[model samples]
Target: MNLKNLAAAALFAAGSALASLGVPHAAFAETTKLKVGYLPVGVYSYFWRAQDAGYFADENLEVELVPMAGGGQIIPALQSGALQFGISDALGVLNARKGGLPVTYVSFNFSQSSDNPVHAVLTTNPDIKSPKDLEGKAVATNLSYNTDWTMMREWLRKNDVDIDKVTFREIPFPDMLPALRNDTVAAVGAVEPFVTFGKEQGANVLGHYFTDVKSPVVLSGIVAMLPYVEENPDIVKGFVKAVNRAIEDFKADPAVARETIGAHTKIPATAIEAMNLGDWETEVPPSEMQFWVDAAEKEGILNETDDLNSLVWSPKE
Candidate 1:
């Protein structure tokens, strides 16, 4: 071989060696890293699926899914810039907004519909058969100001039970069953997986909350601080795309969703099989979100009417 040809071959070999060693090509760029927080519940089906499926990598994004106490409980972290994104309920997002925090819900992962309700008021005391019996009793909810809590409070009021008479306790979802079993709380607001597990633990199923709401109620969603979202609109869009794809993929095969749930939640296979899965939707429909806003205003959770359009980050194609 000629000297020039040998030199070319040697250069090619060096380049291939570098590429094999994961040295980025001249045009390659680092993936954007973002910290996302979730409640670590089985209901966060799509979030776990997206991570396991490499959807985030597909968008040149690296997501760090941090397990938080609860979605609503992580608002302060999100506001402090400690977290780039958080999964929260409509009530939490609105309450945060009303409290003067600039936050917005970006996408809906779970919603309460006629066919599928995400939360329920469960009681070990069969004597407290209905909401009317909740008066003077201690009821526990993971977040005092979240979607399920608001709906349960509203249900109590609408059922002729005075809200002030009921004692509201803040307890984590996992501890709710023990709280009820040990009589720490007379009734506990439980969501999927827990509700099924509570039943297994001999807790009486009172009723599913939001059963009578005429419109679909958003249960939980991806929330981000306004500044973070505004500064990274393209990143936010990519996130939504990955989440939406995950939702569709899960819908196409529900067993896969359940498996993802079990993997993240560590819930037993039997409980996961029996638990009712959430109605997962990616699009943020303004009309559906209005249900929570209206309820919040009427319940005095939000002092003023909220601008629905401003509170959601709907990405345009």
Candidate 2:
């Protein structure tokens, strides 16, 4: 062959090698590094699932999942730019907005379902049979003014229990079981797999607080600062797509969900298997935010409410 013909053959071979290696000519060469904050709980397993299942990578994203204590820390981290994204409860997001911190929900995380309840009021004391029994008792929650705290208070009130008579303590989820076992707290607002683990340690479920009030309540979801979301809409869209894909995969296979959750959390296999996971969803409706807003206003948690639609960030087509 002539030199020009030989060069043409080499170029053809180079293109074939690139195609064989699955390398696109116009590939997304840059990956957006995202520091994502999350509460290390079984319900937020989809974050780990998305990372482990390569959904985030598929979107050209490098997600660093930072395990946070609760929304209390996560919200501030988001505000200060320490975290680009975070998973926070609806109440936390709304409260932050109420306080003039421009944070908004970008995608759904998980919901509390009647069929598969994850959050509950648990007690180890045999004498504490009902909510009214804890008139002068202290109850542990992950944080004050959080979803669990708010719901448990509402649960107590619904049962005709005096709100002022009960005292709430802020304790992490892992420590709640020990606190209950040693009688440090009369009861705990437990989320799984602690709910299941607590039962294994002799704690009994007083009631499913979240589901008792309403079935399929929007619990928490992906959140970010409004400025970040507005400036980087594509990044936000990619994140939403990745998380939603992960949710679908998580729902399709229970075993995979268990494995993914167990890998991220310290829960034992038995507890993970026995525990009911949250109902993960992909969409966050304005009505769901309204539920929390109305509840917060009634409880005097929020003095005034904002338009629910403004609190959520919807991706433009």
The candidate that wins on TM-score is: 2
Q: Which candidate has the top score in lDDT?
A: 2
- How much lDDT does candidate 1 score? 0.80
lDDT score for residue 54 of model 1:
89
Off by over 4 Å in 2: 1-26
lDDT of 2 at 13: 76
How high is the lDDT of residue 148 in model 1?
67
Runs with alpha carbons beyond 4 Å of true place in candidate 1: 1-29
Report the C-alpha lDDT of model 2 over 185-269, residue by residue, as the tens digit. 9999988888888788778889999999889798788889999999999999998899899889877887888999778777778
Which window of ten consecutive residues has the lowest lDDT sum in model 2? 23-32
